[model samples]
Target: MTITPQWKDELRARITLSSVIMRTDKLTKAGREWKGCCPFHDEKTPSFYVNDQKQFYHCFGCGAHGDVISWMTEQRGLSFIDAIKELAAEAGMEVPAPDPVAAKRAEKRAELIDVTTEAQDWFVEQLRGSAGREALAYLNRRGLKPETLREFGFGYSPESKQALPTALPRFEDHMLVEAGMRIRTDDGTTYDRFRGRVMLPIQDARGRVIAFGGRILENRDGVAKYLNSPDTPLFDKGRTLYNLHRASPASRQTGRVVVVEGYMDVVALAQAGIKDAVAPLGTALTEMQLEMLWRMVEVPVLCFDGDAAGQRAAMRAISRALPMLAPMRSLSIVRLPSGMDPDDLINDRGVGAMEKLLAEPKSLLDTLWEFERDAMPLESPEAKAGLKKRLMEHVDTIGDPDIQSLYRRDLLDRFSAFAYPPRQQAKRGPWRGPAAAPKTLSNGARSTLQKSMSGGQRSDLLGAVIAGLVRHPGEISRHSEALIELARHDQSAAPAIESLIELAETLDSRIQTAISAEQGFPAPPVDNRYAFLREGTPPGEAREELAEAVSLLAHKPALEAAMAATIARFDEDPEGSFAEQARLRQQLMTVDERLKAFGRKKAGSDTARDENSVSSDS
Candidate 1:
């Protein structure tokens, strides 16, 4: 049955902030709030705070904050109705039937999916009979096991004109068209979508065959070698990865995911004992795909060809992974030997060789280092300076210092080491020099560079002003002029800072959200700099430190100029008094801490100790 908007809202309300806290024991009752480890992300400190009175929960670690419905949707991977039903069941209630119109639409969707499945089955059966022998032999030649064919739902489409239409009538044809299995011509003629090719079903996380990829069985001299399902309601080439459904669980268990270029590469890797592997479907890896990988594994090992294009793809993946960075999550790029893809490597050098290659995957820094080493003469000072500048630009992109340090160490090791002349040195060509020295990027320098690179003094001005306001709410009154000035300089950060000021002004108000809802995408350096502008500043402290920060803001002229710009930016919005909001936030945080401490004490000394052992930085 189809769920209505009202039903979704009702479901969301039932899973109220209090209900979620009740499910887990770590939550402790403070004066008015519940505090515990966030279920959405791995966090040691109790940053997932729930305001039962407000029916809201927020995770300071991941910035995942919402009502109970959002928690169910994100943490449990449930749709709105599904979340509602689950919560209702927990509360000993039953969900009412969906609206009739919604029910009809849902039924239609289900029918379409069923028809698509039937079409897939028919195609596979046809492959097993006449058209599939050539495809099966092709797979066998590639060392793919018979079981692999069944597991991946391999199939073949005949070159015959009526192979598909002969099996299913117009209903199936429409279904196939809707599922991206076939294309319709202007003349209304229907034909098999993938003729003379080996088919690979592309399934989503739920294992529904939404699309298909076909490798050409008989090659024409100038024709494209492969074809894929077009974008449709059920299939998104950008979002769907081949074999993700089968690979995700294995990837979670292993804590490492292997990403390849094609479906066969994924199959080959699986057959070779590397079960945690997925491939992009007829497209380069995308940010959405990377987010999926982040959910599945702590670290993803991307193996690509060593050719120029492959190296370029690796760089692209590196760029896209920046936003997903958090504690324990990492991206590693392994450049395979030239001219050999994963399948070739597995068939020739075997899984052991692949393991050895993976054992030494390149860090982003190393990839850049090699890229620089090949592009310019290291002996030239200008080249060194330019390379260092470019490298530091990327290094600064890393918000976490610990991760940045590891990259630095790896760079130093590569640059500083002088390879010894092995007994076999005589057989090799060319002599490379001793390794390069490690370069350190100062935290201050990084901040300065980030500010300068992303925008200009405007970003720094905004960051400094916001940092001051968050630490000292009283400073908002004392240095209102400065805040307005800062806000005026950076238009992008103006709204966010204005929201912070407004939140500070109203005790009854929550932090007004100005940042985009999609938080994990790559934001500009200034955007990241401004993330906590409204919430709070880093290195959080007690009332005394906040007061100190305020005092500093009261005197800092630069801060005053920045604050003035900030105020000007929000001139269009209704005036939001800051004192009341700041006071409310202070009270809430205090209450939250009290409740969290109480919960921790109740949980036991060991759990509290463990919480203290880990860093609170998300």
Candidate 2:
């Protein structure tokens, strides 16, 4: 018999998600993580674990685990369709069958809504009880308020082995197992999920409880210091960022999101009246988290702990966040005082102090620029030359000329002492010509080159082709053979061509995947022209100088001699000026490469000519 939609809704409403979790009693908290039994499998010890920051659940023991939906499916023997319907119905809505696609989407959304409401209720109930009172006391000591608590959905998990189970009795043992609340033995018995712990509910962007972080009151060596939900359909640890829902609005208002390292940090921010703050539960900041933060505000503040590891982590975040940057979006690295977290800073120095720091937060480029100035000896010519080269490489990557100019000025100011010649001593010994030396440009050639290459797209179509071929060698073998064959003939295209050829040879799936794009291949910004042109440019040698001049002319003809004079000069002085002759030859090579690339297109048109010739012969 087909179950009516109303019946499913009524049945789901009756199922308490918290009760299901409490039925197993596997979860217990330490400082932050939640430890529990693998509900999907029978195990002696609790191995299923959840980290709110990571937003995922994994069972180190039996390995029977997934996100919330996966857990529900595994434990309840429900198909993905039925499970979504069941969860949606619990949220108190009639399942709308708008269309197959819409129906499926609504079911998924409804399940999340249902699960979120149930978890929120459980958390709120916990905060109202005795154990919740203890948690409240802890928050009070940290200077938090009740209204603040309510706004952030502060909830308490009562300190009872059976309280949650009693509240959610209709929930089946298998459902409880799926929710990361409890585990079952071979005999199929169940108990409380998080015993004797104050719970911190983890919510998604829509403020739904996809997971929980339970804090254990007592110090137990063997027990994990904290407990988290297992990977459920609703959450993935790598993807879940704590306090993002609340922080998003605040970030929108303030134009920044302060990213901390824990749930407590979020509370501290909220308590300090700085609601636009968030943290990852337990894992390192991820690319996905960066993307999420980018969507919310123009700048995301990375507030790392003041220790060495935290600084290292901040650097990593900077590195990851930089590539995702758009024109307006930026990331700032906020280094708290040593031995202090955002929570500690708020508690000791006040939120205003943190805000002040946030206001003047350091940019990654600024930090690296400072580091370069301090680390390098600019006074020496060799040091200055090396510094200029490295700095140019960095400046070349920055698409924004304004930001690049700012960095350039900062670099000059920092290395001013090193960039000039030593002041001559006065004729008399006592006083020198001047205390400071006059500053000079470190390396003019490199600077000029950087300026020249900065004007156009850096994207490499050939590189894109190579990347695609690596990912799908068969695809390259099918369509790009002509292009590859042409590249093989020309020295300039050889590097890009060989890369694709290598991929074709290896036939690696990963390379193929990386190359796959829905639209045309992605070109690096026009500013990246330097990367391609730099290698081809000639150096000090006769042949190298010749090649460099040719490239310069191809890219910027104003720099080269007229075509007729250059050819005549080369012919007459082939014996006299080896360098000039070589340069001319190099120019010819560049022209040849461009023609070949051009010819590939022209060859297609030539096909019509060949066909006409065949018709005439017939």
Candidate 3:
């Protein structure tokens, strides 16, 4: 039977690995997984774990690991076909009948693997022979030790067209071409595909050679510097990372992976004693390559050259990753020294410099913000606004809602800080309450007392919101951003809101007992119609009205500012800008009407109770 990857994936999906393992070994719950003693090794302590979501079981004791099918075959000692038959029967799935084309394709892939292995052996033999003097000198110039070259399987391809064809006579020319070792042009001409270059074998995860990357020894005009094998039944350049066969196990040991630009960079890092490094072939890092990297580490560190092209490459990777971002899954970026690749930096400075960079990398968010923030001259407001649009466009692509919201808020907050840098203020001691404050007053009340007692002005709407917040100090954190923005714009109320935030945990919820006992908190302003200040108002109704009051008092101005920014883009995107402008206008009117509904209510009997404190104190 020919089992396609799609079929295997379906079979794995239908069977929960934990349940199958549980049938043999006693497993107990371990968060979202099951844990028990490993079946492969005897132990008192449990080191095996199974996760149904990922459909796999792994053991930390003896390194026993596999999917459902692997568990059936390896642990039970069943043949591959028998394991599949058993799993299929248990999963209520039908085994696919043999496919002639698929069987032939599989056969061709196996043959191609052999051909590439033979070709690699031939190339290495040439590298150690008289034909490879120039290539050996080039490797020496690059300061590669013999051990490093042997470890990376570095080889040499001769300048002759029939080099691989003559060396691998057992394999037919058609099989050689199919394996990407030689080219057969339409004119019935056949020749070696790689020539006059230092070759690196690109292997699959199982250490089977599947492709080749060649770096030219001689710099000839109109000739490319690096060339990789084309995609064949056995190899897909976009889906393969050079050195992944070695890097995967190394990454598991180190719990990290360093992604470089090319196979040469991967070899350079490995020679520098960094074993857990891999690189994409000549193309930009694709999503499939990213998925493979993510399988090894939660956040792979992309170490790229520090030049413009490297930065662009990093951005492309980041852009591709944004939409696929899940919790704890992202990328960190390391930009090498300007005018230096890994080889250049290790040669010029030392491996220490390269290691330090890989040790600490910029976060995906920080990298994104920095890249777009400095992408172009922001000499104009419109230019600065364009930066924001680019950021949001990326944010919108993210698939996870919680992650998307966080990225959006964080980027916008960062953009706000960048576009409007905080004004410098002279250093001063920490804030203390007024000297004349009553000794028994709560610390928060005493602190807020300074602002009101300083004779600084507070608008009616602001006063009502503050009174609402005082009554419901538990809600202080819910609207922290709006409150902070209010403090930033209105210096008079800054102290009150700032104190309220600090006291959110400590302050008592009862309004009259907390602050009104000392006559320290404000009374709702005259003609104020905020529902929260009314007596006999239900707690839910009061909180809802108070939210609206704060949203109007603080967030409305921000809404207006955003709307104004949107209008600035009217020329660039008339349709989107116009639609956004209209939506914002609607929100503005909605907030205004909600506030107006409160104002329209007469100053109720509750105002008299508010008057009780201020009247006696005055």
What's the TM-score of each model vs. the native?
Answer: 0.54, 0.47, 0.61
Across 1-618, the per-residue lDDT of candidate 2 in tens digits comes to 233545443544455443445454557774566777665445677787765544356767533334443344434434445565666665655554567776686576565545446756877876687547777776676676878777767666665656655666666556556666665668877666677666777887656677788777666988876777777656788898998777765664565688887887788778778888888877788888876676555467888888878877776676566445533357888888999988788778887899899889898777656555655566667887787677666555555543455456556645565576469865543221124452222244223222222332132333333332333334444333344434434455544444444434433322322222221222222211222122333222322322232232233231134333644663344222222322333344344455445345346546765887899999
Instruction: Predict model 2's lDDT versus the native.
Output: 0.57
Error of 2 at 136 (Å): 3.2
List model 3 lDDT by residue over 534-568, tens digit each: 66667778778776677667656666677779878
| Ranking of all predicted structures according to lDDT, beginning with the best and ending with the worst | 3, 1, 2
Q: Model 3, residue 535: displacement in angstroms?
A: 34
How well is each residue in 208-300 modelled by candidate 1, as lDDT tens digits?
777778888767998668888888777778888888777866753564788988877888888888898898876777988886776555467
Q: lDDT of candidate 3?
A: 0.77
| Candidate number achieving the greatest TM-score relative to the actual structure | 3
Q: Is candidate 1 or candidate 2 better by TM-score?
A: 1
TM-score quality measure for candidate 3: 0.61
Between prediction 1 and prediction 2, the one with superior lDDT is 1
In model 3, residue pairs whose N, Cα or C atoms come closer than 3 Å (at least 3 residues apart or on different chains), thus clashing, are none
